[model samples]
Target: MKLNVAALLALSVPCFAQQDPNAVEAGRLVFRMSCAGCHGLHATGGRGGPDLTRGTYSTGDADKDLFSVISNGVPGTEMPSFRGALEDANISRLVAYVRSLSHAGAVPVKGDRTAGEKLFWGKGSCGQCHRVGMRGTAIGPDLTRAGKQRSLAYLRESVVAPDADLTPGYATIVVVTRDGAKITGVEKGFDNFSARLIDLSGRYYSFLKDDVKSMEREYRSVMPSNYGRMFSANDLDDLLAYLASLGGER
Candidate 1:
């Protein structure tokens, strides 16, 4: 008879420790050993994987569902099956570790999203760098699906502290051409042979290493960092609520 993956997953459920005294540590080890590279060491996100700690993952949050996905892997994605890669006991521990991430950094967002939308497009000046539903510029990261993929904590940190966590490939840069021309922009692409940059004015530039005089990587983000001081407590909360409602189930 054909077996159900969910049923099979359930059979192993009881094998997991009830209190799971060692589950978290074991799982942490499992995550580091097997899942961290792509998912990110902190599970915040990585070049190859979306933030696993947040978002509506292909593998649902249920224990059985998570187990099946980890063991069988999601189809049409880089997440490969670990059924043979990890022992069943370790897989159980891995699940516990992943589950803990959800609570590690919870965002306490509360406010009116409707008013927040007005603030985002009008007073906030957020549309200049970020995009939402094809309405804003593409200078910065898009917020169209941010709510679905990002945790409230991440979103909150992004606004008030723009430079706190610069997304990969979006770091600000200053490049000096061999001709003594100084050009600055956020990095849009990079490889061993070349680099691509896009300025705040929507201008794009690509340069070969040999063609440039110098390249200075700036740790500070171009996005304004005084939002925490500009907006009131309620305003910040409202803005977070608005961004958080942008994606996930319409």
Candidate 2:
């Protein structure tokens, strides 16, 4: 007996339904088959892969966004394409699972503005690169009006994993001098003969092509790494909450 075209197509569909995968189970399977060798069996990366549970990628990633990356694979990295290896539905399920693993919690703790203010200035060192209420350094952008621009979640990611999403005018450049000196600074300007750098000291330095050896531009962020480990969980939550409260206060 011959089947109709629609019937044949229906038959071709995989037995698995489109229901969201059991987060834990999907993560377990993904970790075992594809990610385990490089990333440890529990998603803690090994030699070839960075730890997914504790790194920048963990705290800042969104579900759909992670799914795309997992499916498409980053170019020029050790990460390989899983497009054909896993079906699209399965990829979505995997993303959900990864998100489940990274979810610190659904609700952020209520913050103490007074304590947050102290930490922001004293312990967090946020002022080193950010400006608040006309105070603090200008090495980074002014955060006096941050609440107007970003959500609490976005602000949280900015603190814990600033590099995951680079804001404009904030890209950093690395320069290697002819004298074997290396300098990295925010990009001020560039032409064939000259390049300008704005260092952490908020000083702008100009360099001529003849005096420079090599220069490289990184598309990623220049913010210091390992910021996630710098603060206790509550500290991170309070800081994010405080940042979210800014601008709207006035």
Candidate 3:
């Protein structure tokens, strides 16, 4: 969606003016000349950097926090320090400008929880593994509070690519018994002699190596990967919004 950059800047400018007029203007000029190329014309973000608008860095961030990061830059990354080039005051102004961009009350996308509920239970079939608000099976971890623990970006990636980052206890595996019976479960342990499996029933089964057939381990996720195709962008957004709202009751 196209952003109202002028309005955003106009709303943010007065706050900085109260702090330092010259610094704010100078920072604006510097941003236009230097940072605009990488951070976009509106400082929203670009190919090189993350979106500063929706990010967590802005709210309650101290001036010194900004200075340290900007001056020293991030280690082991492409981000570079401006300690030598930009003066302290100039850096502070830049920091102020960046801070001004932070708007906590920004409106989030309105999503439909009713449609999301239908998809979650019916077509999505997400309940097979993931549980929401005490409903569904418990093959995977409870997602009733996932929105509080994870970011929107994290949720998006997780849905689009399930195996991208496997949570510690949720990794699925296949176990072969000594009697040649193959069982699938969340892996508990493995050795030459035996392997342990935790099935959806929360039962842990141990298999002896001598009697087992070939046990297989899959790195891919058990969560289905058709969420992107199944739901519309708005549907996904609403579903994510619902998931995000699941936490905070406690």
Candidate 4:
């Protein structure tokens, strides 16, 4: 499943001229239209997607692996197959653009990571919902590999405006049973026929729409949106530094 020698050459060349300049540009445009939502504008990752600019991927690092994942999508994940949506040539161009991103270095973060760690567990109370490296609750997205899976800009926005880009399954849900009992928790699953939720205490519940009086899915995040006001500028920088330091080579 190797790409042609020309494509492989383009990966090593600065201009990628061997693959044709037009193809690289086309791939950049295609990525912006199709892949940027999850992978970030710079292919650094967004909305829980893994960073592709790191020259490594969870799906495998071969050119064939990238092509296969794009064409066939990963099961049990948000990535969707583009086999029907894009032509083979377009997919190749995308690969070219993605490879180009590896030439760029990661942006440096500011603030003290130690201070940020303190804020995460103490002042921020972030551990109450978010988990990092086997600690904290599972109510929110795990930060165990946050450094590798999200862009710094995306992480900054998440702390101040969580609802701006909601994660797939962490939305808020409210349900009222037939007996007048109300339940509110993070949505675990939802469909036309059924809904599942997990409360703060890590309790899970499922209900059939027919059996419940009402079920409301709030397409916004359950994470607090007041961190911007709560933390000082330095504190925010410290937090970002700590987050950026997570999941890197130990």
Candidate 5:
């Protein structure tokens, strides 16, 4: 079932983040007693729980959503409410503790982030397809928050095998115009009437379905699949590390 994220976002924000130092510690203790079973001992996530440290949430990530998810629980998922078990004040501390996990001071990386950024824009030509921040093209997935959402293993797999897994809303499109002009790129939007394609160079191409001689939807990803062979192992690791740190600092 889909969650009412709109309602979740409309809830009031919690204030535990402004509490005394003891409250954060108290929240940690509460987490161990109440949440660790499913979220994991360190809140790294396990089984049904998602990694709190990644800072990605399906429900909302605002302070209000954090408080609501715990106080009222989600409607369609295994996440349960703590309204009767714990007071609102305690839920605030839990929110504080959860937010602390994503701070750079808490989670550190082993690889060189600087080197990784260099490779991603330089030799990798990633910007040509994937957009990072306000720059790059939209022919591929946006990596601006990749570090905050995807795991290290998942990032590694994506680089090694571009077509191994495809994110939703980002399928490939091959268009053959009536004039015999062929174009291939990532599909952004389409219908029986017309289609939009963001080509490799970040150029946008729109054509009416009837005007094109033929249009084929390809399951293959537009991203190059030779990164595992392109970069040295260490370079690849650094690149992943850099990519992983994109949305983490703030």
Candidate 6:
């Protein structure tokens, strides 16, 4: 049996990355400027981005695959085409940097994971609004893969200051009807003329601006803001460890 050139190149991505330190460094700069905001400075995932150091990607894993995704971007995703923003050589360097990170280890979490799980379900009361795997409710963002999708720092800030970085579409929406009924929930849809929301009960509602007495989309999180004061520092670290461990094995 013989492997094709493309297969050989893919198999030796790590080797290619190691052979050229200058290119890798250049790529690192490019990644820092263009992708670090979403992917984290270390490519460990940040905000809503996926972890790139996991050695696996939702898109194809070849160098060419990475190049394509960066140049053209993934449809229906936050990823945007960089073809116009960067030159071809820069994209290649970026791919090399990403490949170099394939074997990088996940950041160590200092807290106790078991204790964190307890905090999540017990003291944290997070299960009421958030779902991890199939165990919790759906009122908040599904955290089944949060460990893989967010950075440790991001998670910490989220727990203590929920409004610091609002997850897209999770902003609180308040609507008042002409009859004096008030409705509040996360934003499902919004426009100059209409708004849509889903409450804690998972009920969906849509209303036109003219039909409703008033509608306000507060650019803030509905999650409690006093978690920093509610839990001790150790408790926060424990919870973060558990969260960082999610989807890590994949």
Instruction: Give RMSD to native, each candidate.
Output: 7.0, 10.7, 9.7, 6.4, 9.6, 7.4
lDDT tens digits, residues 1-250, model 1? Answer: 3434344434444455435555666677678878878777877655455566653455576877777888998666567899898877767877777778777873345889998999999999999888898788998887887765565667788888888878767888788898898888888876666778899888999988888887766777889899999999999888988987876344
On a 0 to 100 scale, what is the lDDT of residue 196 in model 4?
97
Q: Please write out the lDDT profile of model 6 over residues 84-105, one tens digit for every residue.
A: 8987766877888898887666
Once all C-alphas are superposed, what RMSD does model 2 give against the true structure? 10.7
What is the C-alpha lDDT profile of model 2 across 1-250, one tens digit per residue?
Answer: 2324344233333333224334446545766788777665666444345445532352136655677778887666567889999877566656655666556443433776667778888888879878888788877777886643444555677778888767666788778998899888877777677778788877778888888998766766767766689888878777766775575244
Worst 10 residues of 3 by lDDT: 9-18
> Stretches of candidate 2 above 4 Å error?
1-109, 191-193, 248-250
TM-score of 6: 0.72
Over the stretch 144-206, how does candidate 4's per-residue lDDT look in tens digits? 878766777788998999998787778999999999999989998998989999987788999
User: How many backbone overlaps does candidate 5 show?
Assistant: 0
What TM-score fits each model? 0.65, 0.53, 0.54, 0.68, 0.61, 0.72
Pairs clashing in candidate 6? none
Selected candidate, larger lDDT, 2 vs 5: 5
| Candidate of highest lDDT | 6
> Which candidate has the highest TM-score of all?
6
Candidate 3: where are CA atoms >4 Å away? 1-101, 104-107, 188-194, 200-204, 208-211, 248-250
The alpha-carbon deviation from the true structure for residue 162 of candidate 3, after best TM-score superposition, in angstroms, is 0.4
lDDT of 6: 0.82
